[model samples]
Target: MHIEKNTFSLIEIPKIIDEKGRGNLSVIEKDGVPFDIKRVYYLYDVPSDAYRGGHAHKEQLELLIALSGSFEVVLDNGFEKKKVMLNKPNIGLLIPTGVWRELENFSSGSVCLVLASDVFNENDYIRNYSDFKLFVGA
Candidate 1:
């Protein structure tokens, strides 16, 4: 596999809500065609000083959004690294394949919502650090 470093992508999602609304709705449409949502998951009540997401996927694409409070996502793309702070529900970060990530620094009442392109598969995860390095051709 050919893995490139520093491959994280930040995307702005188009909103469907208007100015008169007090509440919001989640809608995804491309070229006037709406895409069906497959899976929806959220993470809340995360303990302080606790870390999550220390792995990379072989073929999974994920979109991470902070629904409340704030948090930092540390991304490692083999040869480079970056930290992204997520504190708004309207903004989302698109995490691509072959990039290792660690979610940390959760503020009080922080909630993280994740949308994945594929279903869960344990075999697709590279959990070990040395193994992940080797897998990325490090």
Candidate 2:
């Protein structure tokens, strides 16, 4: 089956707030995500005008969270495209395989935290949009 841009979902992470005016905390355990997390990484100190991620995965599922500030994620699933803004730490966007993704509009001090369903595998990536479109037969 083919995945579409509408298939993506935004997940709200559970949070614990301190009543003493301290701070807030969020957790992502086994059930927090649909797939088991096999890898974790983060992007930080990105210029607001810079763009990151211009590829689609063949067999990877990812959850992107704004751990600090804010950024926008542009997603294309061969047939359609959508833009999602991530500004809160307690929210995450679930990206399924076969969908192209791009990151942009980063605010100052923005940090992007990513949780993956698989480890690094260059072969699983489609680096070109045309190739991605061909692969998806769109």
Candidate 3:
């Protein structure tokens, strides 16, 4: 893979409002995107001293949003890096494949929701920092 260094584009998650206060909310994912949702997970009651998601996917794309409270997403694409603070529910960061990311500095009572395009596969994940650097050619 090529060493990529740039700010990845952000995608807006489609929100379905609750009607009549009898149903739940939903987020829809459309086709034609680089990735598709295959698994869903969330974090709740994260501590301020704990850091989450310190890895990169080789082929899977991830979307992260701060449902409650606040947090920071630090993205690194080999030569360049950027940090985005998310506090809104409607806005989210679109993390493309082959980029290293770290979700950290979460406020108490923070709920971080992650939508993945692929299921959990250890081979698809670059777990080691040196491996991530080597994969990005940094």
Best by lDDT: 2
Cα lDDT of model 1 by residue, 1-138, tens digit: 122333766656556576787776655444212123356798899986988899998877677888899999999878888999998777778777788999999998999988876778898888997888888887
Report the number of the highest-TM-score candidate: 2
Q: Between prediction 1 and prediction 3, which has the larger TM-score? A: 1
Stretches > 4 Å off in candidate 3: 1-7, 14-26, 31-34
Q: What TM-score, computed on C-alpha atoms, does each candidate reach? A: 0.83, 0.95, 0.81
lDDT at 21, model 1: 75
lDDT of 3 by residue, 1-36 (tens): 122334476656666677787754546546423466
Go through the candidates in order and give each one's C-alpha lDDT.
0.78, 0.92, 0.78
Name the better of 2 and 3 by lDDT.
2
Q: How do all the candidates rank in terms of lDDT, highest first?
A: 2, 3, 1
User: In terms of lDDT, which candidate is stronger, 1 or 3?
Assistant: 3
User: In candidate 2, what residue range of length 10 has the lowest lDDT sum?
Assistant: 1-10
Off by over 4 Å in 1: 1-6, 16-26, 30-37
